[model samples]
Target: MKKILILFLSIVIFSCKKEEKGFSDYLRSLDTLVLPQKFSLNSTMNSSNKYDSILFKKYKHRWTYAPYGIAFNNERIVGIIEYSIADNGLAPFLITFDNNGNKIDSLNILGNSSFGMKGQTLESAILDTNLKLVVIDSSKSWQVDIDANKIPNTTKLRVSTTIYKIQKNGKIKKIK
Candidate 1:
């Protein structure tokens, strides 16, 4: 009779232990999950300094959603040109897309008059304000200042950001 009671108590304790588990434990039981790609690189630079910008998806000029180079103005994509000026010199590039995947708009980001980037430098790039653009070199960060027309009777805030380059080895090093 004692054995039977002890076994019953152990089973009850084990059952209660399962009930004590929390949400985190329940989540851990899930299998490895993967997320789909929302966006992708539309195009890359033709040379080191000279880049050609192109949007991945196609969309007409949209007023509702603002579109930037190689990014979605809306659910669709629009093309753009990119240029970078660093201590190394200047890189002027034009990247555009064809009716399909073909690349067009061949313009060196930094003009030929200037020295371009050394190697694969631009890991990522972004444009701020209406005219100003920014590029993150392997060693340093650069900000492009552009003057543009703002909203009616409103003060404009100038924003700046710093970007780093990811090495081929998957390591990030700050550009000068």
Candidate 2:
């Protein structure tokens, strides 16, 4: 009788245990992302609902999150997530994880700004085979001197570039 009771309790306990997903599971769930890809504010990419659910549950943020791509090397897994809120354009982020599913670091791949008549900023990013991310930002701003026709004058233009490299240990380092 004691053996039967113990067996019943064991069965109940084991049956109620939930399965936890690890980083590899999440990585496997994503489609392989081709390298030498480009991303911009207007770029469109397909996403997985399951991956999005996992990301959202793990890291809660007010902005809507979409998984863009996945890539891995010998030491780490890199995932790109695009997040956006109302009025703000889409932005890409690079998140790195260790072999055991631990998050090592995250970086926003582009600069965020509001574009308008007075000033406008355009940003784009390119990921290469060497795990280098190059971001280019072009901005134009003009003095608000309205002419007789109520048109703003163009005064200045600025362009900047930033480079980032993914280290073997899953750390994102800004190289330039």
Candidate 3:
């Protein structure tokens, strides 16, 4: 009887252990997370700059739900880009957190022209050899005639491509 009881308790204790979510798990769950539109400066930068910014996500003058892509460094930073499809545009933002998933900051990248992350849906994000955040932006736009209900014969299609690198301090520097 004691042996059986001990075995049952051991099983219960092992089953009760919670599984921790990793960075990859967070990336897979991005579609369900509502990203913050604005962010305060990080502590390291806040003391020197005292900066604040408001960000926006809109396509064709209307607000929409867009989940594009996410990238993580497995340590401190995660960047995500959401895109709107009415015409074509991207809203990229950076999220910083501690090892315990405590949010540090959510800095907007789409607002910065130097980031070159606007006007396209982010395709992919990865950390490069230099540990800089590298992202690829792509989009396709076509002009249509409302009266004809078809694309205009003379209308030209527009495609934009941008590759960007984000620095460690949350500032974006255009790469291509």
What ranking of all candidate models by TM-score puts the best one first? 2, 3, 1
Clashing pairs in 3: none
RMSD of each: 20.3, 2.9, 14.6
lDDT of 2 by residue, 55-155 (tens): 44564223436666575546446555545433555676777766665677787666545577577788899989898889888888776645523244555
User: Model 3, residue 113: what's the lDDT?
Assistant: 27
Tens-place lDDT digits, model 3, residues 1-176? 99999999999999999885454454554542232222212111111121111112211112323434444444555554443322223434555444444445554443332212122233444444453544443443344466534454543334344455555644456676
Clashes of each: 18, 0, 0
The window of 10 residues in a row where model 3 has the poorest summed lDDT is 43-52
Per-residue lDDT for 11-88 in model 1, tens only?
A: 999888844443223223222211211111333223212111122122222211111223111122223333343344
Candidate 3 global TM-score: 0.34
| Cα lDDT, all candidates | 0.31, 0.69, 0.41
TM-score against truth, every candidate: 0.21, 0.81, 0.34
> Considering TM-score, which of the candidate structures 2 and 3 is the better prediction for this target?
2
Looking at model 2, residue 62 earns an lDDT score of 36
